[model samples]
Target: MTNSNVFQNLSQESMSLDQVFHNIVRYMKQDVIGNYRLIFGTDSQVHTDHTLFITGIVIHRERKGAWACIRKVKVPRKMTNLHERISYETTLTEEVVSLFSEEMKQQLIDIVLPHIYKGASFTIEGHIDIGSGSRNKTRVFVNEMVSRMESLGLEPKIKPDAVVASSYANRYTK
Candidate 1:
């Protein structure tokens, strides 16, 4: 057979999203057994000019292969009640900002794990920017997610900060 013909034939076996979902469920069914439930949660928090959002996608694959479903949970940032206390403080100390960021990230990660494949590997990537005076908290959430995934035998890949910088660097060069 010609190379083109070989490529054509191999392409026919490519699995669709539905097929992959089925396979995942079929692969996971035994662990869940008689009682199985899938849940997903996304949480976010906003402190001053900084916003932290985390999204978790969960897929529950069934043993029989036919009963698998995926759920996406998103958490959005909103103003915090503590704003009242910080209202009078003109500038936030590095320690105070760090604590706030860590707390928010933890809250988001705590909600993501229940919906993931028990032993499947996954990664989370995104960007975060805090205005001149604010500390970026998005990194805290990403790091926490990676740590949690590691505990579950899953490896997480976080994109490097240089990638974002390069994108903007190129924008001005040309």
Candidate 2:
């Protein structure tokens, strides 16, 4: 979710997409020979006057360290429809994913190309804030969202595995 085309992390208040890309590159350079996971997710909260959405991007080095950032988007009115809210969250996450062009992805991959034999690898995942568990109201929508993400050529994670959406982004939606 981005209203101003900027994102922020713990250290910076405002950053353009290019800046975020560079930051990701800098972070990966710290350990170019490690496994990398690029994850994106979105969560939303409905308030009296507006609905706040937060999309989180997490660059995780597998069992190693990670870097995360969030983007906020505000809808002018409360969103009470469960399906609509969930659909919008998925859209927002997809938007962030679109920011990574093929060239950029290849650039990141090139960082680990030399050490591929030594376990260096890269993968991208889209974390939807829905689950397929019984008793979960959101379960009904999981397949649709997962299909949408899969169309974008990204692996999808849900619920317990969707830490970026369910845990990180959800925290800021409040």
Candidate 3:
């Protein structure tokens, strides 16, 4: 199949993942602007059991300007049974939850907000690569970033189906 078609198929099968992610992003934004806090942690126990690295990326865009930030969390390799692996993953998830507020603040003041005055149409993108796990963490990270942007009086544009005809494509193709 063509790359575009492959991406389309993948997107369709991942709708539930997308919804969970959106919820996390929304929560992060609310926690930041409303509570003014920061959150962070490592799911070392889970990583030790799962043998995977979970990385999160938050991309905030405004007009022609964008700021991207990445948070790499190592989920320990699986050292025992499924139960142990699950427990570890759960711990890591909790750690991620804790980091939402603080990370959002740093990303906004340090990266995203500065670009706001430079453009109009703003879009904030977030991705999580849970190598061997799921998309839960990635969605959480993105939602947090989006919320922060909103709190700053910016609206976020999250389009999960525009990969083939994306701005990145237009830029490179031109």
Which candidate leads the pack in lDDT?
A: 2
Candidate 2 on 1-174: residue-level lDDT in tens?
227668998899999999999999999999999899999999999999999999999999988989989999999999999999999999999898988999999998899999999989999999999989998999999999999999989999999899999999999987
* Each candidate: RMSD: 17.6, 1.2, 15.6
Give each model a TM-score.
0.23, 0.97, 0.26
In model 1, pairs of residues that clash are 25-61, 25-62, 29-63, 42-75, 43-75
- Expressed as tens digits, the lDDT of each residue in 1-174 for candidate 3 is 011111112123332323433433554444232211121111222333345422222232212222212123333344455444334433443433434455643444543244445532223322111122254434434455445434533333333422211233222212
The per-candidate count of clashes, in order, stands at: 5, 0, 22
Off by over 4 Å in 2: none
**For model 3, how many clashes?**
22
Best candidate (score: TM-score): 2
lDDT for model 3, please: 0.32
Report the alpha-carbon TM-score of model 3 versus the true structure: 0.26
- Return the lDDT, model 1, position 160: 43
lDDT, candidate 1, residue 77?
Answer: 36
Query: Model 2 residue 37 lDDT?
Result: 93
For candidate 2, give the lDDT of residue 168: 95
What tens-digit string does per-residue lDDT give for candidate 1 at 3-107?
Answer: 111100112343433444344345444343322322222223354554333222233332322222221111133336433212211011111222223443343
